[model samples]
Target: MIEILRKRRSVRQFLDKEIEKEKIDILKEAVLRSPSSRGINPWEFIFVTDKELLEKLSKAKKHGSAFLKNAKLGVLVIADTRKSDVCIEDCSIAAITLQYVAESLGLGSCWAQIRLREHNDNISAEEYVRNLFVLPDYYLIECIIGIGYPKNKPQGHDYSTLQFEKIHTNGFKND
Candidate 1:
């Protein structure tokens, strides 16, 4: 797992190739296994592969989401707010789990944050997505993860660059 984490990087540029069905199935299973508060599992996933729909979803945010148009798959991480107050945290865990599983399968992925983001000046990114898919108002859009074969596998962050200062022992120290 640590080796996978060391190699994992957010890949925005992907090769024009479709992901294998087997790999897709693995990704689906990985997210479902993600842990949630008291196992309520409020998350819902939409695995998108349609080219036309991917193009539309690429515009979910003004920035940081244009890469979806070229991705072979986009997983929308959403959750039922009515089911849990920790929907955000739960969805986040699932999203990252999906990413890690994709990495282990030799695929690259990038996350496009939807919550608290804007598609346009007047419309929130979440609203645009809800309207596009006609999702219920109770469902909250967390983010969309774009996945595919990487055009270029970028190197992961160097260990020397890690912020060791951020690690605190038993308690917070001002030092």
Candidate 2:
């Protein structure tokens, strides 16, 4: 499991192949088993396999993430903000867990931020997403993850050069 976590990367490019039903089921099980804050379990998932909708979503953002179009599956994680104050954190944990599970299942995944400053004030994108899923008002779009087999291996990064500079032991930092 540690090795899987270490090797997982945001794979944008994917092979032109469809994912197996059993693998998708395993992925769903991973999300369903996530631990929620205060046991609220205030999370909802929308599995998107429609190519047309994926294409539309790929163009919804300015950066133009074409990876959505190639992904075998896309999962939208929504948090019921009306249910708890820790909805965002809970939803985020679920998203990361799903990503890790995907990696463990020999699948590649990447997270796309859907709820941020750009979409909060005015939820045009959110509206589109909600309409696509026919989601009720109680739920809010938290994030979208694209999953599939990788087309190419991700490049490696060196962390040996990185160092913790400002982290304190217990009290205030000393100069």
lDDT of 2 at 54: 83
* Per-model lDDT: 0.97, 0.82
How well is each residue in 1-175 modelled by candidate 2, as lDDT tens digits?
Answer: 8688667779988999999999999999999999998899999898888899888766545553567888888899998888988888889999999999999888899987777524334555666677777888778888789999999868534456335666677788668
What tens digits encode model 1's per-residue C-alpha lDDT throughout 1-175? 9999999999999999989999999999999999999999999999999999999999998899999999999999999999999999999999999999999999999999999999999999999999999999999999999999999998998999899999999999887
Point out where model 2 deviates above 4 Å: 117-123, 161-163, 166-168, 171-175
What are the RMSDs of all candidates, in order?
A: 0.7, 2.5
Best by TM-score: 1
Give, for candidate 2, the lowest lDDT window spanning 10 residues: 116-125
Residue 29 accuracy (lDDT) in model 1: 95
